[model samples]
Target: MPTLPLYRDDFYLSTAEAYVSAVHDDGAIELDQTCFYAASGGQPGDTGFLERADGSRIMLGETRHGADKSIILHHPLELFHSDMLKNPTADQSAPVVGEKLVLHVDWPRRYRLMRMHTACHLLSVVCPFPITGAAVGEEESRVDFDMSETIDKDAVTAELMRLVNENHPISVTWITDAELAANPGIVKSKNVRPPMGLGRVSLVCIGENSAVDSQPCGGTHVSETQEVGAIHIAKIEKKGKENRRFRIRFGVPE
Candidate 1:
């Protein structure tokens, strides 16, 4: 496994190509390089297809984080899978190492993830309490924070709308593994932090506010905050002492 493109720059990539390094049965292929973002950092992987030099586009099913944590696995579309089911030897059609292919992501879906992702940041920065954890989805987002005795949905929603209305710019950068190890607060992990010796970690910065909370993240986001339209705090819950959960949704009446 090697460094992937999605981790470096996520502003949106075009005119890139990579050679197929290996393939799994049923349309999962590994490429030498890719722009498809994997399902890490609590953000879903990118969805799209790969086109061969033969003018054939093998549709991508879903992007998943490989156990290796370095390589991204792309599943072929259902139609492609159906063909494989029709012929058990369909695995033979898998792209071979050294075969050049063009990868394309469903821009509409990718855009939605980006918007929702930026919205998650809004949920964190706009609110008063500090975030302890978060999870983002295509339709919704949730974040856990350490707060006072009770959480106020109306106030939080108002703050998020105000922030989104401001339309802040988002950016990402890569920090070396040594720096990340020196400061364990950079990336968020489960009970234990993932090894940072891999050489570089992705840092997502929202708004140019130096006081805003910054963390190591691998998710996709929008260029500006205004794109997250008409969002509100759809739900809230108490998750134990000092932890309050907030579920954010979009397209709701203002």
Candidate 2:
């Protein structure tokens, strides 16, 4: 069985854990715990590597969830574990049933993703329309919303600029999947939920308006809006029939 990801509890920094499971056939390894964030919650997968006791190392290419939901599929860049199976005998002290390991994630990439993800939330307060869909990424981000013809894109742009000026704080917390299940009303508004059977859920809050905008989420986010100071409405694109998409991005003004 694959290990549960502990890094979701603390996404701002990288973490280390012990060796837990390995797959011989596919040349992959699953640490007892990992700092490598999986690709879920609209936030992209984290990129990094693993180092063994003997100085041998492998690249972590992909971190994704399996069908069973409890197991995580890890794809390594090299055949770091191929030798263990091919050899008739196991090393006297080689990692077998249990061993110690460390998980390291690229901090710069993670920091940027957190900033972008939180900015997307702040955007929600400024953009009057209810969001239909959204995505948070390292380079750019987008949010689509249900629109009325009276909505003015230009006015919304000004509103966003004002929020950036206000610099409201951002925060996060966790709730049992059951707590969310009990309150179906909040879950329906966001249109996203934690993986089924997962024990708990992480929630991201916008400013102090927790009662109004607290949402069930598992993505990384900034400590406060100050970090996401001033975002520009890069573009406003029309999609489908009545839906409109807003493209948002962060940059130093010229």
Candidate 3:
């Protein structure tokens, strides 16, 4: 069944009520609707816990998509150490289908990721180069550009901070799949494209009227530029003859 991705509409929603639609033999639980973000793009999946009727918690290690993008699978933390469901102890039974639960996101970890992901977007705006690769992390993130131009890290950091200080509103808008296909230039990645076939694509817009930047993305980000806070380009490396990797970190450089 296609799980309702609540995060798409509300990134700040950390808790949500959902019914267990299915529970796989491997211990992957599916929900009718979820705020838990499934791993996509360069952002990691959300890790949290689910609360049952009895107030017992089911610690989820990560949220991921199943066979399709719409099918979200929540993997329990216990699945990592051992298969708790394989031999259900009387006290620790697996979550049954149709069970109602409350989802709780690991807010601190998620907030860091949100800040770092937003910083990556700001980096792209400052560089204005085709992104070859990227990764959103808790402490540091990297955005690789498909350019050979030698740029100063300090200069890039200054530009990123400028945008952050400007306090631009970060917002999301949806575009139809056909509309996205019509406007290929909005995509910044050189090799990777935004997830399609789900009917519509999300456009992450910065500034009042997307004056700074607007591109196709499905990753979660902070609501405002100022929320990115104290980010700097820690390093820029030559990955290839035509590729430069910029490392983004939180805080002022020493």
Candidate 4:
């Protein structure tokens, strides 16, 4: 069954009720619906625990997509050793195929990620260069730009904080794949195109009427720029002849 991703509609949704649709041999559990954000687009998958009706907890190490993007698998932490999900032991017990479960997302960690992801977007706005790569993390995030211009990290940090203090409202607007194809300029990533073939794409816009920035992204973000809070461009490193990597951290520069 295709799992309905509840987070796509509500990033703040941390808990939801779902039923196990399939239990993989590797001990990954698939649900009919989930609030857990599956690992994708540089954002790590959600880690939390599932509660059975009797209140026993099944600790999830990660939520990720199966070979089919629609099939989301929640892996038990016990299956993971050194961040890799190992094959299940022969004696390990698994969730019943049709059992009910209540999902819970680790909110403090997820909120940090959400804030960091939004900060990455703000970094793109400040740099205004084509993004080559990026990753959102709990303590920091890095955005690689396809540019050779000499920029000041402290100056950039000031601009980032300016936007953060402005508290620009962030919102998601859906557009058809055809519309996205028609307006490629809205995409800021030089190497990654938004996930397509799903018929529609989500454009995460900042500011009123997208006055600040707008780009297609599948990752989670906070509701407003101020929520991003105290971010700084900690370092700028030259990756190659033209690639510049900016490291963003959640605190004022010392």
Could you give me the TM-score of model 2 versus the true structure? 0.81
For every model shown, what is its TM-score relative to the native structure? Answer: 0.83, 0.81, 0.95, 0.93
Where is the poorest 10-residue window by lDDT in model 3? 78-87
**Tens-digit lDDT track of model 2 for 62-94:** 676655656665567653543666863534233
Maximum-TM-score candidate: 3
* Residue-pair clashes per candidate: 1, 0, 0, 0
> What are the lDDT scores of the predictions, listed in order?
0.71, 0.67, 0.91, 0.89
Greater TM-score among 1 and 4 belongs to 4
Quality of model 1 by C-alpha lDDT: 0.71
The lDDT ranking, best first, is 3, 4, 1, 2
Candidate 3: tens digits of C-alpha lDDT, residues 1-254: 89999999988999999999999989999999999999989899999899878766889987999998989999997522134446455356788988999999999889999999999999998999999999999989999999999999999999999999999999999999999999999899988899888899999999999989899999899999999999888999999999999999999997
lDDT of 1 by residue, 1-254 (tens): 56366535754773368888777665677888888877766677777778776655677766886667776788877424445656666543567788998878888887777888888877767664666777777778888777755657778788888877877766776788777778886544433343354577767776786335466766677767788888888888988877888888877634
The reply for model 2, stretches above 4 Å from the true place, is 79-97, 150-154, 188-191, 209-212, 252-254
Error of 4 at 146 (Å): 0.5
Full ranking by TM-score: 3, 4, 1, 2
* Candidate 1 lDDT for residue 212: 55
Clashing pairs in 2: none
- After superposing candidate 1, which stretches have Cα over 4 Å from the reference? 1-3, 25-27, 79-92, 128-132, 186-195, 209-211
- RMSD, every candidate, angstroms: 3.7, 5.0, 3.3, 4.4
